[model samples]
Target: MENDREGPVPQNGSEGPVPRVGVAVFLLRGKTVLLGKRRSSLGDSTFALPGGHLEFGESFEDCAAREVKEETGLEIDKMEFLTVTNNPFLDEPKPSHYVVIFIRALLRDPQQVPQNLEPNKCDGWDWYDWNNLPNPLFWPLENMVQSGFNPFPID
Candidate 1:
């Protein structure tokens, strides 16, 4: 197959590539969802889901499970595909783009408490009411909220 994507364009001597793929796990327990205080340059100080860039050849479920375990030390029992977001941060100070896959998941052990496994990337983890998420959410998350996409929908 011919590659449709052009080569990385030079931007101030740095190569800029296409949108990277990522996964955001919505770990739900009752009416609450798990979120972490981001501590990195990108979206710093915002409360966001536990997730990261997806690796080549890995399934979305696998990426969500791995990211949840790595970021919060909790294991996901099962997950369902929620939605996909095309996030372009052209106006942000650090312009970037990501194709984010959102997944709603349940914990393998209900009693398993989350821990700050990646202190460098996140300050800590906590649960918040779905209707009242903390201030300054990551761009994709903010977009989701504005679009009225609820991770927890009653049957």
Candidate 2:
């Protein structure tokens, strides 16, 4: 992947290879939500939602479950669509991904939610009231939470 001052470029079939993709699931509980701190070297050690890339042949919902389980070890009772933000930061050869797919997920047991992975995916895990979540939630979660937009349809 060449790094020019501009950004990334898609490779021609005769030139190189296809790009890799990733996804994110923003699981919400009541007025509170879940966020994961990046212990890995990928992001800026910033705090974000619980999610990861899509596996080959896996449905988006399945991938969402997998990521949540891998990171938080909790099973999501339900999930609803939220929003998609196209990350406009990339350079040639190395394709930058769409970043994340936000989803509002309902957890069966918010009080009993546990982190199964050791040392754990993040250094810490805590639930925050959507009205007053910490300011450092890297994405536009605060705005979304405030809007009261319910993606899940009620019968």
Candidate 3:
């Protein structure tokens, strides 16, 4: 396996063949959820949940909490496993793959406003009503919607 400063080099000499494991958090407040516009190469300008690659030895719940805090600067209180997705961006201009673990969580402080801690990776954060999400969602999110995976469920 070839390795680079970034990480392992894919056999195809593009990205990596190993599916990068990541965690996405759906931070909920009432009927709205928090979303950020990605600024990175993988899904630039697309609306995505706050998340990143899972660190080695980190539990999914811990990764979700950590990523939410790191990316949005908001602490999460409770988190539950929502779903998992195997996203293969073979048709994308820049092909890649990911094994994404989705987790549903609530903000530790309901009144706290999210800040963009990493502007290089994300433009900013905004709350959108679950019923009316923004267009051009990230591929995994688009798939999630098409598959009838509603993040918000009536309890």
Top-lDDT candidate index: 1
> For candidate 1, what is the TM-score?
0.87
Superposition TM-score, candidate 2 onto the true structure: 0.68
Q: What is the C-alpha RMSD of each candidate to the true structure, in Å?
A: 6.0, 6.1, 4.6
If both were scored by TM-score, which would come out higher, candidate 1 or candidate 2? 1
| Model 2: colliding residue pairs | 7-91, 8-90, 8-91, 8-92, 9-92
For each candidate in turn, the TM-score is 0.87, 0.68, 0.87
Residues 39-117, model 3: lDDT tens digits:
7666678898988777779999998888888878899987889988887667755566777888999988898999988
Per TM-score, the best of the predicted structures is 1
Compared with the true structure, what per-residue lDDT tens digits does model 1 show for residues 46-153? 889988878789999998998898888899977999988887766665566777888999999999999998887888999999999999987778878998889995
Worst 10 residues of 2 by lDDT: 1-10
The CA lDDT at 67 in model 2 is 73
What 10-residue stretch in candidate 3 is worst by lDDT? 1-10
